[model samples]
Target: MEDRKQALVSRLLQYALIHEVLGIPYNEIVIKRTFEGKPYLECSKVGVEFPNFNFNVSHHGDYVAIASEPLCLVGVDVVCCTEPEKEPVPEFIENFSSYFSSLEWDNIINTGTSDEILVDFYRYWCLKEAFVKAVGSGLAYGVDKVEFHHTNWTNISVKVDGEPLTEWRFWLFKLPERHWVAVARGHPRFATENYKRTICKAEFDAEEYHKGLNLPNVAFVTRIIEQLIPVSHGEERPTMQDICSDCLHLSSREA
Candidate 1:
């Protein structure tokens, strides 16, 4: 279990290769907590000297994801559709409903399909989580300070601190095995950004995962890898590692 955390940290560092390109060293990466309880990294070695980069991470059962950007705050979360301990939905809704426009809740409650309803509900939850994370206050901001306008299944607009968020965007994608991921970013534009999203299966030879947290025997890690890796939907398959070796060989010739 401890090794799993190490592996995740290693993988996250690998995914943040952009920082290395910024000339930041691993030892120079400074992760600190804000007064609002959000965690941020100081990439001074990479030239982002002014505390401009922020990130958030979350895991469901086994899967985990992180988001980061230059000169902008970013928050990311992934939630497995597996129902959590049921509580009063209205209680939560009432607590933060004021932040939501009347039409928002109306549309939320009137979602035509169950899957759509569930997706929207989680979207709202993740968006709020990401917003609070972006604000560096976690739940201290009282979910009321942030609101989301779900224009459709894919598009969403956010309002924070009573200001319309035009410099931000949220992306929601469905992962295989009923998992969903969301990212909230304060960048001016994402469509033109150099973004790399990859979901690869890091094979474990001796079941390095699922040993801790006393989870069920049901296949959770496999499901998580499926959710993170970008592959044909509904196609459960494995690739030979020799394919990577072959690519490395071919690349050396070009170099």
Candidate 2:
């Protein structure tokens, strides 16, 4: 399992190669940890080189995920559903209630469907997590301080203990049995006009991963990457298939 996890991390780094090839310096690369233990990559140089090129990555259990854009401040998380914790709701609310508005909680509790409630509950959790993750504070930032736009779920307005972050967007989606994913970017704009180019750019090519896996399993990794990326991106964001397909095509030509 350790070997597999390490291999997964290596495979995951290949996605970063796109940045490197674009003349983003490796020595200048910066990765930092938050007070609550979230990891953030610092691309001060990359940000300058391609102001529109924003990216973030998260991995959990069997999945590895990444998000990149021509320009945007972004954060992403991948959480596996195959290992749902057995924690109770009241306890969860008790610990995190300060984060939810009364209306939000009311909407959650009053909603009749169990799945809807569960999904909503997770929606808040993952969104908050993504926000803190975006700013590099992780869970140390109070969930209550970060408020989300109710209508679109993309806009975020933060009231942290010290200061406020002006505007940002939060997005959350499910990735089948493997995980739930979340993203935060420094834009309130969720319109698809800018997204068409981003989806075209952010992708993973599994052939690199294939070098270390069995032939049959190589196809499985490719399939999983294809299936999950689009779900995470949805209609508004670029699907993983679009990016990965481009990557594979490029690799084939070079070969």
lDDT of 2 by residue, 1-255 (tens): 243442344233534444343554333334443333333344444443344454555556555666544444456666554323576554544565767766567766666655556566667666676665554455555666565556545443544443655545455666767357777665413223333233222222454222211211111122343332222212243333423332322210010
Pick out the ten consecutive residues of candidate 2 with the lowest summed lDDT: 211-220
lDDT of candidates 1 onward, in order: 0.48, 0.47
Query: What does candidate 2 score on TM?
Result: 0.53
lDDT of 1 by residue, 156-208 (tens): 88776567866666777667767776776654222111111110112222332
TM-scores of the candidates in the order shown: 0.57, 0.53
**Candidate 1: stretches off by over 4 Å:** 1-23, 48-51, 84-101, 113-115, 160-163, 187-255
Top candidate on TM-score is 1
